[model samples]
Target: MDGAVIGLIGTVVGAVSGVLGTLITIRLGGAEQRRTQNDQSERQGRSSAYSALVTACSRTYRVGYAAHATLQAEGHQQSPNDAETLEEFRSAVEEALEAVSVVKLHGPNGIACAADNLASAMSGWRSEVELLADGRGDDQRASEAIELYEELEDRFIALGRETLSGVPARP
Candidate 1:
C-alpha cells in the first residue's frame, strides 16, 4: 500500500532529521561553551596582571617611604652625615626601583602615565643615591633627592587610589 510506504518513509526521514539537528545543536553549544570559557580565562588573566602590578608598586612605594624616613631620622639635616646610613638608604631606593621595573605595570594609558611618573621619580632618587654613595653628597643633592622622592610618593599614592577604585580589596 502507498499509504504504508509513505508513512515509513516519513518516519525514516523524521528520525534522520532529528539526529542531524541534534548533532548540529550539540556542536554549536560546544563552540559557545568554548568561547565563554576563553572569555573568562582572558578576564582572569587581566585581573591577575593588574593586581600584581598594583601590589608591586605599592610594596616598592612602602620601601621608598621607609628609606626616606630612615634618612631623615639619621641626622638628615646635619653636616657630615654618616656614609653608611646614606649608602643604606640609597640601596633601599635602588631595590625599590628594581622591584617597580620588574612589574612592567605600564599600560592602559592612565596606568602608563602613572608608571612613567613613578619611573622618573625612581630614576631621580636612584641617581641621588648613587651620587651619595660615590662620596658626592651635598646639601643640593639632598634637597633634590627630597623633591624626587616626594614625586615618587605622589605617583604611588595616585596609583593606589586609582587601583583601589578599579581592583577589589582583600576580604
Candidate 2:
C-alpha cells in the first residue's frame, strides 16, 4: 500500500478510538452521578424520619402532663395511687422516650433502649404519683418520682443535643 494511504488509515482508527473512549467515559460518569443522587435522597429520607420520631416523643410527654393537670383540676377523685393513673403516666413517659429514641443518627443509638429504661423507671415512680394523684398526697413518693423523672429527662436532653445538632430539643 502507498505510504499516504497507510497514514490515512492510521489517522481514522485513532480518531474512532478517541470518540469511543470519550463516550464510554461519559456513560460511566453519568452512572456515578445517579448513584450519588440516590444516596443523598436516602439520607434525606432517614433524616426526615428521625425528626418525626422526636416530634412524637415530645407529643407523648406533653399529653401526659396535660392529662395529669386536667385530671387534678377536675377532681375526678381517682386515687393517683390507682393502677390506671400510674399506668397512664408511665405510658406518657414511655411515649416521650419513644420520640427521643428516634435518634438513629448512629448504630444502636440506644434511643429505644433508653426509652425502655425510662419506662421501667416510670413504673417505679408511678406508685408515688399514684398516691399524689389520688389526693392522698404522699410527699415523699411524689418527690422520689420527680427526682427519677428528672434523671430520665436529663438523659433525653443529652441525646437530643447529640442526635439533633441543628434542631432544638422540644420543651
Candidate 3:
C-alpha cells in the first residue's frame, strides 16, 4: 500500500507540471502576439499621417505657386476677376493648415515643429501676395517668403523620411 501511494503521488506531480508548462507557454505567446499587433498599428498610423501631410503640402504648394505667378503677372493691376483666384489660394492654404494639424497630432515634436514653420511661411507668402495684389508690396518680400517656405518644406520632408524609416531624428 505504501508503494502504491507513492506511485500515485508521482503521477499527480508530473501531470501538474505538464499543465503548468503548457499554460505558461500559451500565455507568453499571446503576449507576444499582442505586442506585435500594437507595433504594426502604430507604424500604420504614422505612415498614414505622414502621407497626408506630404500630399497636402504638395497640393498647397502647387496652388500657391500658381497664384503667386498670376499675381506677379498682374503686377499692381488688380482685376475685378482676381477675387476668384485669391479665393482658390485661400482655400488651398486652409487645406494645408488642416493637414499640418494632423501631422502635429501623429508625428513627433520635431516634425510637427517643421510643419508649423512651413505653415507660418505659407501665411507670410500669402500675405505678401495679397500686398502685391493691392499694389503696395515689392517683389522682394514675396521672394523671401518663397525661400523660407522651401527651406521649411525641405526640413519637414527630411524629418518625415527619418520617421518613416525608423531612423532617429536629428536635432
- The clash count of every prediction, one per candidate, is 0, 6, 0
lDDT of 2: 0.59
- lDDT scores for all predictions? 0.59, 0.59, 0.84
- Which segments of model 3 are wrong by more than 4 Å? 74-76, 168-171
Backbone clashes in model 1, listed as residue pairs = none
Model 2 stretches with alpha carbons more than 4 Å out = 68-76, 79-171
TM-score of 3: 0.87
Give a tens-digit lDDT track for model 3, residues 1-171.
699999999999999999999999999999999999998987788788878877887877887787788778743367776677777878888888898898899868888898899899988988887787777878888989988988888888888889878786676
- C-alpha displacement of 3 in model 1, angstroms? 2.1
C-alpha RMSD of each candidate structure in angstroms = 5.9, 5.9, 2.4
Work out the TM-score per prediction: 0.55, 0.50, 0.87
Order the candidate numbers by TM-score, best to worst.
3, 1, 2
Candidate with better TM-score, 2 vs 3: 3
List the lowest-lDDT window of 10 residues for candidate 1: 99-108
RMSD of 3: 2.4
